[model samples]
Target: MRSARRQYLLESALMTNPLHTFQAWLDDAKRHGVHEPTAMALGTVDEHNHPSVRMVLLKHADEQGFVFYTNTESPKAMDLDHCPFASLCFYWNPPGRQVRVNGRVELVSIEEADAYFNSRPYLSRIGARASRQSQPLDGYAELERAVASEMLRYPRGHVPRPKNWTGYRVIPQMIELWKERPFRLHERLQYTRTGNHWTEQELFP
Candidate 1:
């Protein structure tokens, strides 16, 4: 019964602009206190064409692209440098919805990254400085020491965004939205981007 009602609502939304429907769904998730509402699994390929995936927080999204922040020198960023193609998968289990995006990734303008960085909490800015993501940690004590050192350096005043940390925007070529339904059925809507327009189609599941 619940799944049926959700399916009905989702189908109605998808009948309209699927992008609008997705933003509405994401807004609902944010309002309903879904932790990490914009968190998505990012998939990318390295130089040798090996696939890798990791959870990344979505910082921005619009008709233009989907954006996330990361250290520019990180392994993922290095992979993105080599191969700009990537994918994002967002699953909201409580809402029984999933959104998939496949696209070419690009670094957002430095100004844009700076503005977003300025908006982040001071501690987060400091934390960004302390973390060397994906690097093998010597120990918890070592991490704490780094944090303490950074905190002392910043001293509750303004924290500058690290030069290495910035944002990447994924310009989608394909976007797919799915909603679970009863009796093993599901509603799937896909949008394929071509030039300035997007073509929408429904898929059987």
Candidate 2:
């Protein structure tokens, strides 16, 4: 492909507000009932330099970055504690679009977590308290019993948020948006944050 042609395609994407463009796609995905459209693969590294990735729901996203809830005592949390950098990739296969973000990890404000927790179902809140995430479980019956016990303990269904379960926000430094095209070519646009400004660039596929 001619460099000029490629650059034109890239310019088309860049000239349009990247944030708004991508957000529009996300909203469309949600409206189309894309299964778990907010879910992304979260990647983190441990102290020993081993990398781990898992599908986590993207609970929040904006100029500040992305946020997701998890057990603070889980393996992922341990890894985050040691290495506060992470990456997130969202793939909307049906729409043939993808977004990748690299960012530093930070614990979301208590207020945010509390509000989200309160929005959860009563039974879900109880289950969050009963399950010690990432920990070995004896059996399904044991888990059910634990949940039942916790439910009884909070008969009013006003379960408090678990101290060990909270939210983490990723402060993005770089974000990439990819779109599928014909002839084995793909469109890639990236936005990088440096200090107070954002820089946009195009990558060849």
Candidate 3:
């Protein structure tokens, strides 16, 4: 039934705007009570050309592009430093929609970072500061100590965003959306940005 409805939407109107369609899919995911609807797979390549991928939450999305926060000291950070390009994939089960985005990454504004950091849970804020992120630690005790130290340093309701804790925006050059269909057949649609305009194409699946 879900696939049938989606197939009708795909065949009839198709999406005119990928961003709008992406947002619609996201809304559908939330409505279906899907867990971690914001989660996306972030793909990056280091200077050595080795590829790495990890899951990251989608913090914000707009005409500017997709935004996600991270610790700048992590391996993914180094990869982005060497190569600014990134690919992102988001999948939702009940809605059975997936979105792929390829883009160049840029640091988000300090103001945006500060606001988002402040909005995080108190413990999450402390955890962001406590973890060295990709650095070797002595043991689990060391991690606990670090967390305790951070709590004492910030106290409750006073955790501040670290300088290394920042956000990045992926300015998309291409966006492809996939909708699951009956059997093994699937539906794929792509949008390529040309100047300020976008060109859309349906793909074979």
lDDT of each prediction vs. the true structure? 0.85, 0.85, 0.90
Residue pairs of candidate 2 with colliding backbone atoms? none
Best by lDDT: 3
lDDT of 3 by residue, 1-205 (tens): 2245445646554566788888888998999989999999999999999999999999999999999999998999999999999999999999888999999999999999999999999999999999989899999999999999999898887787998999999999999989898895888878999877888777787
Q: For each candidate, how many residue pairs have backbone atoms clashing (under 3 Å)?
A: 0, 0, 0
Candidate 1 colliding pairs: none
Q: Report residue 171 deviation for candidate 1 (angstroms).
A: 0.8
Candidate 1 lDDT over 1-205, as tens digits, reads 2345445647555344556777988987787778899999999899999999999999889887999999888899999999999999998866788999999998899899889988998888888999998799998998889889999999986788888999999998898988777886988878898886878776887
Query: Where is model 3 more than 4 Å wrong at Cα?
Result: 1-14
Residue 47 lDDT, candidate 3, scale 0-100: 91
Prediction 2 TM-score vs. true: 0.91
> Over 4 Å off in model 1, which ranges?
1-10, 14-16
* Shift of residue 180 alpha carbon in model 1, Å: 0.4
TM-score of model 3 relative to the true fold?
Answer: 0.92
Clashing residue pairs, backbone N/CA/C < 3 A, model 3: none
